[model samples]
Target: MSIQSILDIGKSGITAQRLALEVTSENITNVNTPGYSRQTTIFQTSFVTEERGFPLGTGVNVAEIQRAYDDFLQTQLKTEASTTGWSSTVLASMKRAEQLFNEFTADGLGKSMQEFFAAWQDLTANPQGQPERQAVLARAQQVVDQFHRINGYLTDIKREANQSLEGITSDVNESLTRIASLNDQIKLIEIRGARANELRDQRDLLVRQLSEKVGITYLEQTDGTLNVSLSLGPPLVLGNKAAELSLEPDAANNGYYKIFATSPGDNTAVDISSIVGGPNNSQGRMGGTLQVRDSLVNGFLSDLDELASSLATEVNSLHSAGFGLNSSTGLDFFTAPTVTSGYSGIGGIQLAISKTADIAAASVDPVTGGTGNNLNSRAIASVYDKVLATSGGNMTMEAFYNALVGKVGVAVQDAQRSSDLSEGIIKQLDTLRESQSGVSLDEELANLIKYQKAYEGAAKLVNVGTEMLDTILGLIR
Candidate 1:
């Protein structure tokens, strides 16, 4: 080769070696960086040819630093990851609620109800005894207290769920703003035809996090921005812009919060409670809390009202139909006003037996109470049987509550199963993505050795060219 051609080759070789070293160093430095893809420099032959176009001399030139990535596989991974995240979040929250109810536990509400009924059975054995009546009253009070405790617990859970929703909304809004900022940055970076791979990874992670808070879908726009939406069909974030969500007190019932959305531009409020089904109507932990509060707790309250009404109606009716022990007077043992329906509100009801009994009329025996002429304990016993019968053989408010709690167990199990299936699908997708884009240490090490050898060879050529030039100068001297 001529000296000039040799010099050119040496210079190009040096450049190729320097570029290779830089790429190797970059890969080693970012070895532990999360989501970082390894990059490799492509070297092309720079050929010197004669007029006939036949290649004579050649050296290497660094072409492009290609990023090891698979866009299609990554997209698939992110989608399944988002779905898995959502299901897991919902399942966790539902499981927490299930633990609160503890349906099968001996100390749970179900057991408390059973004890109340057993107490009632003891009272029924001796109706006239004050101790028996007092026992019944105490047991009845215990049942009421248990109902109120469960009701309070349900209310607390509902409040907690609302708070969780509010927290999630705040998180979503913050994430949306961050994503918008990143979007603008990515657009600027990509304007010159360079891929913002690291920035894109950050954005994908954020999107996955956002999906867990609510059922969400996102679309990539033509301009390289993302459009985000909730399952309720409302836009959460649009491109580089975002909408805010807030909670407002319900107009009809100030106790509950109604979810509302506000635009970023003008802050115009749009009610989203109906769309998302409010805190209680949601399908996850929020839904479970709502069910416990409205249906489970309220149902128990209704049963209590029924028990009180039935007891009052049947006992008062029997007492009014016959005379007391006093032959001179005929009066009811307990009287106020009869409740027409089991659903009637509890008001103006009191339990009291008449103080006086007429013993003057001798037509009836006092020992064995008569139906019409004397005090009839049999009448009271018949009414007690009616109360027991109305309870559907269980005779206690607690028994009814236990039955309801059993249904909650089935719901929790279903949610767990769904979450497990979703997680499994997500894991499979993740493996596929990792195979496509994830860095392999063995592969990277091999690449490192190859690049190192190329760099060394290139540097050697530059050194040889320098020595030859020195030798030519020495010969001239």
Candidate 2:
């Protein structure tokens, strides 16, 4: 081979290896940067020439700059991010709900109910004592106050979940728009036969964030664009256009917010709450928040109202049947409930009689003390052991209350377990992804050394080729 050909081959090798070294350096620098993928140069042989019908070897050229990645691994990460986000949100909300139940604590409903019943038991001892009647009234009021306090706290929990839902939906919409813009950039760059490796990484990062807020499914098109959609709904982003999500206040549901999605090409926005937070979905942060507000909180409120209504009805029934110490007949101990918005249960629970003399301690109109006239107070105390009206008539008031609190505890445990399991899966999948796509300083430093040596060897060959060319020209001159 001619000395010129030798120089040409050496130059090509130097250029390719130098680019490889630069890529290795970049990997090392971006090792800690989020969403950065490791890259490497792909080398290929240059075109060959024929001399006397035999092929002459040519030097190598860089085919393309290829980034290290795996499609299936990225897909797995997105899916698990949605799942983990869901359970984590639910676990937090349920923890707040558990605090209100306070079944095991002294300041909770269990303690108040026991004290209220004990006051009635005290009344059975002195059928005509004015002080005992006054004590019973005080205990009943405390029980009523506790029910109001717990229900109010539960409403606040539901409100916070709604606020979180609003924030998550906004974030998901922002990510969708950004991903669509990245799709346009990637398509334009790849069309010109260039690698948009960094852009692809940025776009993938946005996709991961979107999935964490709302579960989604995305597919890559032939032109390297993505079509993104809700997990069970229509397209959210198509090519270069993304959908905008907005929430409308639902008048039918206590003016709570409902989600709506509008694509760039479509004027009408589709409501996606059913697909997102409905019973079909068990994914994403918004889904978990919606479940807390709509399902768990409401159920607890319903059970609490039943307990208050039943207690009031049972006491008033027996109290009105007996005669008061003042000889007044048919007087209810507890007043009728006044209906109110969001709280028809415990809002109007007040004592019916104004004075302690109205205490019904006799079954007859005139009680002369030694008769069996304390029967009405005894019946009122026994209401605690009776089956709750809404416990399917199988469980007593105390047993039913314990079960209601137990339900909240069970919800918290299930959410925590789900969050933990999903997090374990995400961590394992992350390790696997890092092995395939993430930058490693140790691996990059070794690559730096390898590429630097190849560049030096190519430079030495070029130096040798130049000297050999100089000697040949000197001889010819």
Using TM-score, give the best candidate's number: 2
- Output the worst ten-in-a-row residue range by lDDT, candidate 2: 337-346
> Which consecutive 10 residues in model 1 have the weakest lDDT in total?
354-363
lDDT of residue 433 for candidate 1: 56
lDDT of 2 by residue, 88-115 (tens): 9989988988887876357888888888
Which residue runs does candidate 2 get wrong by more than 4 Å? 52-54, 337-354, 366-372, 389-393
Give me the runs in candidate 1 sitting further than 4 Å from their true place: 1-52, 56-93, 96-105, 263-266, 276-403, 471-477
Candidate 1 is scored at a TM of 0.71
Q: lDDT scores for all predictions?
A: 0.57, 0.84
Measured against the true structure, the TM-scores of the candidates, in listed sequence, are 0.71, 0.94
> What TM-score does candidate 2 reach?
0.94
In candidate 1 the C-alpha lDDT for residue 233 amounts to 56
Which predicted model would earn the best lDDT?
Answer: 2
Candidate 1 C-alpha lDDT tens digits along 275-346 = 554443343332333343334444544554555555556555555554434443344333344453322232
